[model samples]
Target: MPADENTAAEATEARRGRGGRGERGGAAARRAARSGGGPGQQLTYVTRKLPVYEVLGEEGIALIEANADTVLEEVGIEFRGDAEALALWKEAGAEVKGERIHFPKGLCRSLLSTAPSIFTQHARNPERSVQIGGDATVFAPVYGPPFVRDLDGNRRYATVEDFRNFVKLAYMAPNIHHSGGTVCEPVDVPVNKRHLDMVYAHMRFSDKPFMGSVTAPERAEDTVAMAKILFGEDFVDQNTVIISLINANSPMVFDETMLGAAKVYARHNQATIITPFILAGAMSPVTVAGTLTQVLAEVLAGAAFTQLVRPGAPVVFGTFASSISMQSGAPTFGTPEPSLVSYGAAQLARRLGLPFRTGGSLTASKVSDAQAAYESANTLNSTMLAGTNFVLHAAGWLEGGLVSSYEKFMMDVDQLGMQQRIAEGVDLSENGQAMDAIREVGPGSHYLGCAHTQANFQTAFYRSAIADNNSYEQWSSEGEKAAHQRAGQLARQWLDTYQAPALDEAIDEALKDFVARKKDSMPDAFS
Candidate 1:
């Protein structure tokens, strides 16, 4: 056998040997502790033990930073529609030319100094709260998909029911750490009023941390009001109970809609993830280096704006980098260049002393097929290895993010469990050493029946919930099923068995009343 395989076999054996008949009860207890005594009992997030894969050297990073500073100083960024934002920039020594704000060198960085490097987003269930920075990595489900592929393989516009279902699935998923915002856009609900239902669904169906609506400034205000209802006003005021996404219009622009929402969240002491939604060759330069410079410039300006709203607010440096097919003008995922961008961008975020968000199980495939699997894996793996702190769209993405697939969600969740294990790195404990088992088994003899093996076999390896490893004859006897088919079955089973975490009666009633009054106050506008 090759050395690496041989080493892996030995490590597996050692891990298995760490337990024995005497340790069985302790092993079970340990398992319970790790799993937080079953789902929904205690919320948990991954703290990576593996070293981050850094593709850029110090010189490369310096070059990118210098270029980004030049872009900010020379070209400047346009702040359209928000005069208040422009005024603040001018007040802070930036040269405001019409709507464009020319930031002096080191201005954004100085402004970001007050932003917290790490902060906790308090879930209604305190045990479900997550740390969002440093070594921690939190996984949130797919966000903002307008369509969904149901269990039967039919794709259709997502409704509020579909939205709630995705929230429930995220809650039940052992690997999903956050109940993501806008899991899929509920087109059935009026555009003006859907945020109410979406926020309420996350509050009602799941106890995990969730994102706030940023569609409009008033909608963001509504989200804060509702959050105050769920979590007390004082708690909401003093703590970060919500984290919202604020995307910059790529190529050096920050629209008023995003700016307004960002100000609302920042002023309320909530978190704002400033992401540059860049599609290379369209929104950004085709070269990875060029893209990195632009991403850094955009993130710096947006994140700095949050600090300007409130000095000590929490903010995340986020980027969504993907390439476009030059010939077809369609976005591409899981490519090498995007991975490089992710790695480089992560380094930049770290250098700025802020939490970073990037990467997801992204794919352009319309269905959960081999193409989807390969593309999603490429992006997902890079996301983890790049040391991403907060991950949005960690699962269920398909059709270049236009649709969320039920089967793909489950498959991605299974892969997420693997990522969790990878983040745990290697166990160097005495049990993991397995010296006693090795001594007993000696050379050539198998240790399968040994006491340690017998005791630890159940938990020694990450048993995939989706992959089928059964023999061909057994597989044929049961009806051969593709991965998507198996995943679809799992999704159905989870939804069937899902039991929502309890909420206080008063809080639930208040949330419902708030939604009703808000809806009644506004006439439904589909657009």
Candidate 2:
């Protein structure tokens, strides 16, 4: 079912602080606070232990140092963005060819030394959840790919209405915590105004921490400015509310826009997540080692910029990357390379003492199908096992993350629950409820009528939603629809029925004025 009434009511209760058992009193809160999970970051599966790294143990540090040397020497990265980066690398005993710069082994070691392992992402909505250090996972809204299926089912280019509607849908979503939106369809906001809309969408629809989609240099500056304005001047400088994610163009490139954005965040000691999306056998070499060499080079290059721009910037070594398909020659989302890369990334990120951003629910298919489930589940499993600190696309991605499908959105929520169950790891700390209940009636005991079952049932075991636990006859009669159908329906209903939180009159007016001024300056973008 598409977010049944119980789910809706549960959501309501959660908003009002009543439904779940998340609340904690004095000692528990203090203990939880003392935990390295961080005040802003809460692990959904707190009891579930991820495989921790021994970065400085034995020869691990030496291994990382060796790897850095290899990356800079043999697996050297080439940059094709600003001449400044090239000049810097060339001065550091590197090669310079036009805009492309080959990083030296010494530079890589120096750069890698400055990165960190765990950091926090604070939300604008104090009530909303933030994540870091593999403690919690994040679900981002769909983006990029153009075109939509109209009411009559004809595929056509998307418009501003489509963007706004998608934005509205993202804003209305119950489980998703961040709104990755400019939400203005193909109407196309000017490169700069896109940042404004993204910031504005977060301002209007969510109090949650949102991603700033700054596609270029000027836009990145605008984005940082907006954050400083929305929050206090010291806010972005302090890694609160807004955290900037900069993707280094793979196969040796650091566009000015990305480098510029990294500069802003790094200068402020705010968060900067450097990622690379490489299409294997295409943009990257076909072989895994070749891909890693190229990817590691990009990482080091970004690390160099980050440290050079400002030392000690709160940076995340994100492996939000995927490989390409050899057959179709397009990017492949659901594949083994992402998992492998994510694992290696986690190991490397740990060495930096920085949090890792890994993959999740990524797929090549456009809609929520059986293909979607298989791919997403496998990806999630791999990332979680890899001890990834932060998970992107944890929930709600469909049509290869190009188009948002509500059906898949809610299903992802359910999938998250399932994954959390894995982390729950049998719950041996359930006060021995299972055995006690079993012993309550001896070997032949019937616990169904026992007080243990009556009182501690909810905490005693694993539960499933997408999977049927009912009798086979009942399941057969119900006519099973894949989780996608259920998710799609939920997305539609959320768009149609869910209401956004009220905004302050003054803030709303200011936002409207901001949009108007921007729109006037960039009419070409107000699609």
Candidate 3:
């Protein structure tokens, strides 16, 4: 081994030795528990035991709903560049003026009645399937970042290898339940054909439920066909195997691309998350209430369109709300205004009886520094308390969603493990009372040596994988590495140790064949 590698190994061994038997045992116990039931055994998704925090009272919620209705009835939302969508609206009793569809007072809500309040998105490995509504909180990795900050802290355009590495990282993370779509845009692949590689990475590298391509209608169709080949045609048609994102162009418009993708997913009995991408001052009103109203209005139109395509189809009411810096005209994240918007939007989704999707570890910092930590914590806390059902961008976001940092990804994964612990709430069982421990260890004596303490010590607290809790002397003696440095080391270790889940040979061959045939059918389009 190299000198540096030998030094790192020696330091790690020294730390383990100094941690004592209890800490070493705890770490071993956690590892054993994770691997006990084979893959997908470590908690599939979080079911929150704590009550959801609500910011809007009855009157406040009613006011926002009324304003959203007025926006739909008066201003109307445009279904741009898709005459088929306009025709669907017209046929469904919505008044079509050009490409804009003016809905009646209760049209969208009534149409959404057929949508399920909760549904399961089936993974190729059934054990990894996730419940995406109600008390469930499913964490997926970051999506749509064009660049990556590598282990050496250099930023560059993301490639297909980076995409697959992210998939492997997400699969290895116990708290990230879903393998996200477009973890980062692979610039090395053709824009028109990259979805094939991206989707294939998700299927081949992970067994978790994943999002689908929605960049174009045909790409969405290709996703469905590939899913059919993997899961079988009849099974794919009968169940919700793939869930995709369909973003409504903010300020009340559903562009042709999103509209077309949504229709394709809906018609095939798949799931779609109808999100309105909003920036408080630019795409929406600056005020929280105004932003909530616009978000509801946009989600209503987009989700209602899914039901129109196929009644009883699953859909998630999603919002991506941020505020922009007034001076620079750049997007800002982890701000108070967007947090308020998330809270209000959650209440709105509940009132409409739909699954809500929002919030993540969002930040605008160029690297995984103090600023990134603070911003990501703020947003993640709000996301948990606000009752977000399906959290996209739950990890690895940086530089205003432009770059995915490897160190930040591991840091966020550690935080997500903490969130999982928080969601468990307090335990009031007899064992949790600890009266026996108090009795055994009398006043003035510590419980560290008590029987109860020994029995429960291993799982008593959440241990952060990226945090260094050793003495200052010990830290300095090792290397005095910063948190990001430690996180980078851990990320490298995980990638080195990652093992792709078992996949059937026939299914794998079929998926590859489908991808090859589809790529051959179309000329590559970079734009």
Error of 3 at 227 (Å): 0.5
- Tens-digit lDDT track for model 2 on 353-467? 6677767677766666778888888787887777765566666555565654445555665665555556645546656546766668787657788877787554345343344
* Backbone clashes, each candidate: 0, 17, 0
**RMSD values, in order shown:** 8.7, 8.1, 9.1
Error of 3 at 431 (Å): 0.7
Model 2 RMSD to the real structure?
Answer: 8.1
Worst 10 residues of 1 by lDDT: 15-24
Tens digit of lDDT per residue, candidate 3, span 239-294?
78899999989999999999999999999999999999998899999899999999
**Residue pairs with backbone atoms closer than 3 Å in model 3 (clashes):** none
Candidate 1 Cα RMSD (Å): 8.7
Which lDDT values do the candidates have, in the order given? 0.89, 0.59, 0.88
How much lDDT does candidate 3 score? 0.88
